[model samples]
Each structure stands twice: as structure tokens, then as C-alpha cells.
Target: MIRQTGATLTGSREKVLQAAAEMIAEDMGTNLSVRAVAARAGVSTGSLRFHFPTQRELREAVLRRIYGRLVSDDPILDRSVPPRDRLVSCLRQVLAPAGVGAEARRTWTRAYEAFLVPEPTEQVRDAYLAYEREGLRRMEYWLTVLADEGALPRGDHTRAVHFLRTVLNGLSLERAMPADDQILKTETETLFTAVDAVLGPATT
Candidate 1:
């Protein structure tokens, strides 16, 4: 058995996840070696490998952890909030640029990029599919709640969800590029305006 070092031996699974997340955020998509992660976490390589034997396993764990942080358990699907407003909030949270700090942005960018890569392994593929499905499910949930509350002008929840997901994905890619603040703001506003034109305005 691999011996854990320092206080990590007593640390929960969440601690391992935090260490991995910090590493990914700091490094972006580069140098995600098990040895590196072990060193960063103050644990033996064997211990890290014992917990996650394969690279894919560790990547999937990190993906799930980040998803959990991004997606709320009690999502604001309340019918009281107009569907458009709810959708905007959801998209903004999903696509907001990493942040002011280089580390924060780099971490988020790495995590997001990892999710986009098409892994050949069956387990990796399954995990990716699960992530995609969960995203769609969230969109569907928002659309359904809004439709029920008479927020959507037309209630094709499935179609609306699909369209919104596509748009969000496209916008996310665009926002990932290096652009001036004014250009970024204009592009984001234009995209949101287009979405609003289709989805209708959010009522205060």
C-alpha cells in the first residue's frame, strides 16, 4: 500500500480533489503528470495512483468535481424568474471569462479545454457523454420551468434547449480567444441580444 504524507492521510477525498483542481487551474492544459500532482499534494506517487490508477480516471474525477462547483444543486429554475432571465444567468455563469487573476482563468480554461477533448477510451467517452447529457438536462430543466410559468413565448422546450446549448458553446469558444475588452463586451452583448430576441425578455 502507498503511504500518504503529511495531513493528507487524514484528509477526505475532497482534499485530493482540491489539490488536483488547484493544479489544473494553475497549469491549464499542460503538465498533468501523476508525479507532479503527487508532489503538489504532498503525497506519494503510489498513494495518488492508488486512489486513481489511470490518467483518465483522475481527469474524470477532476471534471466531475469542477462540474459540481459550477452547477448548483438547487438551480434557480423557479417559474417566478422568467425563462429568459434564468437562461441568461445560466449561460453567463457557464461562459464568463475565467476572471482577472491569471491563475483563476488559466485553471478554468484548462478544465474547460479538457472537457472538449475527445478521449478514445470507453470510460473517458462515457464520462464525456455524461457531462454533455447533464448540460442538456440543465438546459431542459430551465426551459420546462419557464414554459410552465408562461415565461417562454413558444414552448418547444427541447428545441429551445438545443438551440441555447449550441449558442452557449459557440460563445464560449469565441470568448476563450484573446480579444480587447470592448470587442469582447460587444460580442457577448450581441450574442445575448440575439438569444433574447428568440427567447423573449426577462421580466423584473
Candidate 2:
């Protein structure tokens, strides 16, 4: 067990968030606190505060850390690629298991469970809301870009974004539930097929 008294303070922001995320990802955020997170990050509480001033801020940061790949990285949005292809890449990452990369799907499973509790702290509830909001914003941004390129059929961007997200979430749950590999593959194809039906093929 690492002692807090021996805590190190040279941690980077990304390192601190990564440590906090791992801690929560393993134990469902019950171990989330400045002292605990700092200890895991090898930093003192004061140092953690230097990076994130409030506990709420720290929790929010952890949420972002978990979803950062979806929020920050886009490998297929280049103009050189077909807009449909780019959109498919975006959807794959957005719906990929948190476990698909370095994370465990259980991490996100706990998050979703938390969202359904009878009651939650305002901060916790807001964290969930902010997460979904950020995802939708990213989806909308991509859809708008595709629309501007005449890749998608003319339609309501808001409705399109919402519908696509709903479909993605449902399909994600199928695999996230530990569905059979073949079922997962089939559902994934269904997802792309639905996308094509809604967005139509890329235009000239």
C-alpha cells in the first residue's frame, strides 16, 4: 500500500487524471477523493489541487479522462477521405467499449448504473449530463461537417444527431452486455446500415 506521507508532487495533469480514472475504473468511483486520487497519482493533495481545484472539478476531470479519446481524437475526419467513411470511423470510436482500448467496459457499466440510482448528488447528476452533452456536441459537429459536404441527405441536424446517438447507444449495449461475437458483428453492421439509410451515400 502506498503511503500518503510519501506522496510525490511531480505528476502531470494527464498522469493525475489517468491515475484517478484507473482508481475509479477499478472501484466505481467510491475511492474518488483528492487524498486518495493524489496518493494513487503519487502526488500530494495540495499538488492535485493545483491541477484541479475542487473535488467536483476533479470528478468531472475523471469523466472527461475516460471519454477523452472520443472527444479529442479524430483519425478519419480528413478531407481526403469519403465523408461516409469518416462518419463510420467516428461512430466506431464513439461506440467502442471503454474496455476496447485501455479501459474496462465495467468502468462505463458502473457509470451507467450510477445514472439510474433513485437519487444522486447534483454534481454527480451534472457530470453524467455533461458527458452526454459533450458527446452529442461532437456528433453534431461531425454531422454538420458531413452535411456541409453534401454527404448526408438534407434533414434536421438535431433530429439526426439524436437518432444516431440513440441507435449507437443501443447497439453498444448489445455488445457491452457480453453478447456473442457474431451478434456483435451483426449489430455493428446494422448500425452502419442504419446510418446509410438515414444519411444516404456520399454525394459527388
Candidate 3:
């Protein structure tokens, strides 16, 4: 009876997590409330609360789930590829979803309107932070993998990850703006430079 009850609780938690992941994928800033997720999962608010307890816990759980799906087949795990090449591919993948030209512009425009133009509510702010934290987590993981393979020196990667992410964010924003063919060339050059700096002589 205890095992059966535990299984039911686990099932309920997975359902709620799936609902939250769907909501996050649909929109980063909205549709993450307990009420909304419970309705989507076809579960009771009380059940979600019993499992997650706080908004932070719910968001973190959903972020991990989403990140797992995003990077489950990541090339970083493919030792056949040169570590530098793998890292470049990883960086480019960050901008792939945003598209280019008009599509990128639209993506950035929507983000500005949602989180920048108006003061974001508490929930919106929390959701945004969750995404940022997840990004950092991913960067750290990539750096660790490289270090494990002796392609990178093992040390605190916090600042290096932050720098890489900042560069990627800038490049992502640049994609939304008007630019010529030179931009693409420069973007690749920029990634190479960042990776070179972070990985030092190892990548060469």
C-alpha cells in the first residue's frame, strides 16, 4: 500500500512537471502559475502544492526538465568531434531557435515588450531568472566536460561561463538588428575568439 501510494505521488509530480514544461516552451514569461499548470495537467492545485510547495521549486524543476530535453542529444558528448568544434556548435545552437533577419527581430521585439518595456511582475521576474540560472548551469556543464577531456583546465568556471554567455547574448541581440553578410562572418569569428580565450592553448 505504501509503495502504491508513493507511485501515485510520483506520477502526479511528473504530470505537473510536464504541464509546466509545456507552458514554458509556449511562453517564457507567462502561463507558469500553479493554477494554470494544475489545469493543464488535469491535477488539483493542492496536489501541485503538495509536490512543489513553492513557486521557485516548481520553476526550477520545470527548467531542469526543459533543459534536459534541449540538450539530451548534445554534441558535446560526442568525443569523435574535436572539442573546439563541438563547443562552436554548442554556441551556435543557442541562436538557432531565434532564426535570422525578420524572425530574429520579431523574437527580440517580443522579448523587449514582455520583460523590458513594462515592469515585469514578480512571477515574470522569477521565470526570467530561472532561465538565466539554467543557462549558467548548462555552460558550467559544458566547461566541465571539456575539462574532463583535458581540453580545458579544471578550475572555477563561473566567470568564464558568465563571459561566454554574455558574448552569446550580445550576438543573439545583434542577430535581431540590421546587418550585412559580414555579421555572420564576424559572429563565427567572435565565437572562436571567445572559445579560444576561455580554453586558451588547449583548443589550438
Candidate 4:
């Protein structure tokens, strides 16, 4: 559902998105300002608005890039692994401890924060809905694949995915903030147990 916003875009439209991505890469600042993105794109703020039509759309582009980097290297996309393992790998991608997956977990937290911030533009509001919808779609798709392969049972996958995602979002926020190892581990266990409850055992 999060198709490339760049696809089928016009000249200035694509340029603006590229510019926004670069600006975000240079600095994913707390402001997430449209004026800054428009400036970097070398377009007038009006032109940027014409192309994106809203701060939310521009923010969506930027948010997309932020998450793109984090999930790009996920083990779920690794074709060599079996389907069941790959599914578990996707779950673990978020629940990862303070080691190899720590950076990604941090990025996930940032992405969620980006989502939480209010947007003045209605276009941005719609874009935020799109973001949430696409996320849910992909999560459900993962569950569908496992169920088709007889690794997971068929049920209300949407609700199940929602439960898992809600838990992950909570974990992301808590992990992103300063917290004791004990608290993080408690939540981490909660996350794992919740996932296991949804999908059953990873081995099965």
C-alpha cells in the first residue's frame, strides 16, 4: 500500500520528493518543516505545495524515507530463509535487543513519533491515514503468507496484526526513551509473548 510516491510523478513533483528525502537524510530534525524541504528542493514554498499539495504529503515522503532505510535490510525480505523463519524474523526485527537490531529499533521509534505529530494540512491528515493503513496491510500480508504455508492458523488476521503492531509501537516508544534494562526486558518479554500468542510457536 505504501507504493512509491515518486512513481508516475511529474518533473517538479519527483524533484521535490528527492529534495525532501535529501533534506531528511541531511537532518531528520525535530521541526520536520515544509519550508526547509521546499528550500532544499530549490522550489518556492508555493511550488512545493503545488506538487505535494500539503505539509502532510511532504511529511509522508520524509517519513517514508526514514522508515525505508530501517526496513530495507530486514531479514523478512531475505529469500533464503524459510517462510516461517522469515515471518518470525519480521517480528524480531522490531523486538531486537540492544545489539545488532538496536539501531533499527531506534529508527522505528522515530518513525512512530513522526506519525504522532499533528499536521495542519488536510492533505497531511490523509497522508497520515495512508501511512497507518499501509503499515497494517503489510503486517496482515505477512500473516497471510504464513497461514497459506500452513505455518500459522487462519483467523481474524487483521485484528491479530493490529494487536501485534500496537504492542510493537508501545515497545518502540518505551525503548526509544530512557528506561532501565529491567523495564525494557519486561516489555520485550511482553512483546515476544504477544507475538507468539498471535502466530503460535515459531518452530511450528
Candidate 5:
């Protein structure tokens, strides 16, 4: 009976996690809630509570799961690609979601309205901070790997990570706004400049 109970618990936990991930991907997690996730998972609230115990725990678990998925397919780990190229590719990947034309504008509009325009509530602020911290952590990891491989000079990469993030943020916004083909041309130039600034101008 105990073994069966354990299996049931594990199954419910997996279902809850998967449901949360799907919600997050679908609507940027705007409607995430224990009740919503429980419904989506086809599990009782008691099961979600049993596995997650707290909302914070559930949120963190979902974020970690999302990042884990990204890490599994991350180009930063592709050693055959030169570090500079890999970094540039990673930056482009970050901007890729902004898309172009109507899709990019819609993404930008939703993001601005959600977290920018009016003052964000405490929960909104916390969610944004969580995502920002995760982004910084990912940037640090990429730079650390390059440094360990002698592709980058060893040093504190905090500023470099922040700089890269800032550049990407600006580029992401730019991608959504109206611009000529020159914006497309300059986007690559901008990425290279940011990468070179961080990695010191790619080895010959």
C-alpha cells in the first residue's frame, strides 16, 4: 500500500509540474495559480499541495523546469562552434522570440503593458525579478564556460553579463519597433560588438 501511495504521489507531482510548464508557456504565466494548475493537471488541490507545499516552491520548480529545458538544447554548450560565434548565436536566440512584424509588436505590447506601464504589484515585481535573476544566471554560466575553456580571459564577468543583457534587451525592443533593413543589418553588427566587448574580439 505504501509503495502504491508513493507511485501515485510521484505521478501527481509530475502532472502538476507539466501543467504549470504548459501554462507558463501559453500565456506567459499570467494566470498561473494552484487551482488552475490543479485543474489542468486533473489532480486535486491536495495533490498539488502535497508535492509543492507552497506557491513559492511551485513557482521555483516551474522556472527551473523551464530553464532546464532551455539548457538541454542550449547552443552555448556546443564546443565545435567558436566561442564568439556561439555567444552571438545565443544573443540572436534571445532576440528571436521578439519575432518581426505583428508578432513582435504584440509581444512587446503585452510585455510593456504587463510589467512596465503602470506600477507593478508586489507579485508582479517578484515574478519579473525571478525571471531577471534566472537570465543573469544563464549569462554567467555561458561566460564561465568560455572562460574555463580559455576562450575568454578569466575575470569577474558580472559587468559583462549585465552589459550583454542590456544589449539584448535593447535589441529585443528594437526588433519589435519599426525599422528599415538597416536595423536588420545593424543587429548583427550590434551583437558582434557586444560579444567582442565581452569576449575581447574573437581569436584570429
Candidate 6:
């Protein structure tokens, strides 16, 4: 009986975290009080506090959950596919919306906006730095995979990673805007051309 009760408690905590993540993603700077999260999760504020004692703790938890989801669902690290295809898949995943929901867009926009801000707690800055490092690491991994498959040259993989990261960052910023299809197409093509110059032919 005690074990079953504990399981239920765990599930409730998860619900709170999920609710907080959805809310934070929608509005990073928006008020995410314990009461607000508890209300959204259909739990009492006391229960939410039991799971996350402070607002900062709850916000950090939400950010960690978001990062975990990104890592798990990332298409770039798939090893079964050809390197070029895997790279393309990874690029597309980053460029395209993760989902078609308004909540998803809001969450993504909020996260991006947070990263842009320079004034935040040390913890927040560290979290942003961690995210940036992970991005670079992923780029390096992709470059190594491509080189192993003879898709890219076997020299200076780090430089290639840096270039790709720069291009990706620029593309991401541009795509985040409320642009039309033609503009998106043109920007994407321009980015692709630059990528091809560094990585060789992107086509298989």
C-alpha cells in the first residue's frame, strides 16, 4: 500500500513538472508562481511546493526537462542512416517547428528569448552555456560521422563544426521571425549554399 502511494506521488510530481514546462515554454518571463503551476496541473499549491520548493527550482526543472526532450527527440544522432541523410535530418529538425501547437511555438520563443537576455541568475547563464556547448558537441559529432563516411574531407573537423554552428545559429534566428514562404526559401537556400562550400556536396 505504501509503495502504491509513493508511485502516485511520483506521478503527481511529474504532472507538475510537465505543466510547468508547458507554461515556461509559452512565456519564459511570465509569472510562473507555484499557484499558477499548481492550478494548471490541477494540484494544490502545497503539493507543488512539496515537489519544487522554490520558483527558481521549478523553473530549472522545467528547463532541464525541455533539454532532455530535445536530446531524446533529436534526429541528428541517428546512427543507422547515412551520414549525409542524418545530417540533413538533424538540420531540418532544428529548422522546422517541433510541433504544430501554439504552446510549442510559445515555449520555443520563450526559451530563445531567455537565451538572448544577458541579465539572469548565474544558474540561468550556466544553463544557456550548457545548451550552447551541447550544440557544438552535436555539430562535432556530425562532422566526425560525415568524415568517417567519406562525405566530408578528413581535415580540421573542429573548424567545420564551428562553421556549421555559425550557419545554424544565423538560420535559426532568421527562421524565428514571422516571414513568408518565399523569404524562408531564399534564406534557407542561401544558408545551404554556404554549408555546401564548407562540407562539399550535400546531395547523395
- Leading candidate by TM-score: 3
Off by over 4 Å in 5: 1-7, 29-31, 67-72, 202-204
Clashing pairs in 5: none
lDDT of 5 by residue, 1-204 (tens): 334377798899899999988876665535457899999999999789988888767877888778766555788888998899888887777677678767888988877766786567776776677677778888898999899899887889999999999998898888888888788779999999889888887442
TM-score of each: 0.54, 0.66, 0.87, 0.57, 0.84, 0.55
TM-score winner, 4 or 5: 5
Candidates' C-alpha lDDT: 0.63, 0.68, 0.85, 0.63, 0.81, 0.67
- In the range 91-204, model 3's lDDT, one tens digit per residue, is 887777787789999888777766787677786687778889988998899999999999988989999999999999999899988899788889999998898888874573
Q: Would you list the rank order by lDDT, best first?
A: 3, 5, 2, 6, 4, 1
Ranking 3 against 6 by lDDT, winner = 3
| Cα RMSD (angstroms) for every candidate in the order listed | 6.5, 6.2, 2.5, 7.0, 2.6, 6.0
- Model 4, range 62-167, lDDT digits (tens) per residue? 5665555556676655557766557656765645532324564667555545555545455445655655765676678777777776667787787898887887
The residue-by-residue lDDT of candidate 6 on 1-204, one tens digit each, is: 224378778987998988987875565555467788899999888778888888767766676677556655765556676555567666656556543234345646767677656467765666566556666766676677777767777767777777777876666665555666575567557656755766666445
Off by over 4 Å in 2: 1-10, 28-31, 55-57, 69-73, 98-113, 147-158, 176-182, 202-204
Q: Output the worst ten-in-a-row residue range by lDDT, candidate 5.
A: 24-33
Candidate 2 per-residue lDDT over residues 1-204, each given as its tens digit: 543333333345667888877875665525367777878877667778887898667776677666665547674468897776677778888766554322435655677666665268775566566567767877788887877777875556888888888987776666556554486468668767767766774332
User: lDDT per residue, candidate 1, 47-135, as tens digits?
Assistant: 77777887667766776677667765434565466555556676676655444335445644666565556445564455456456667
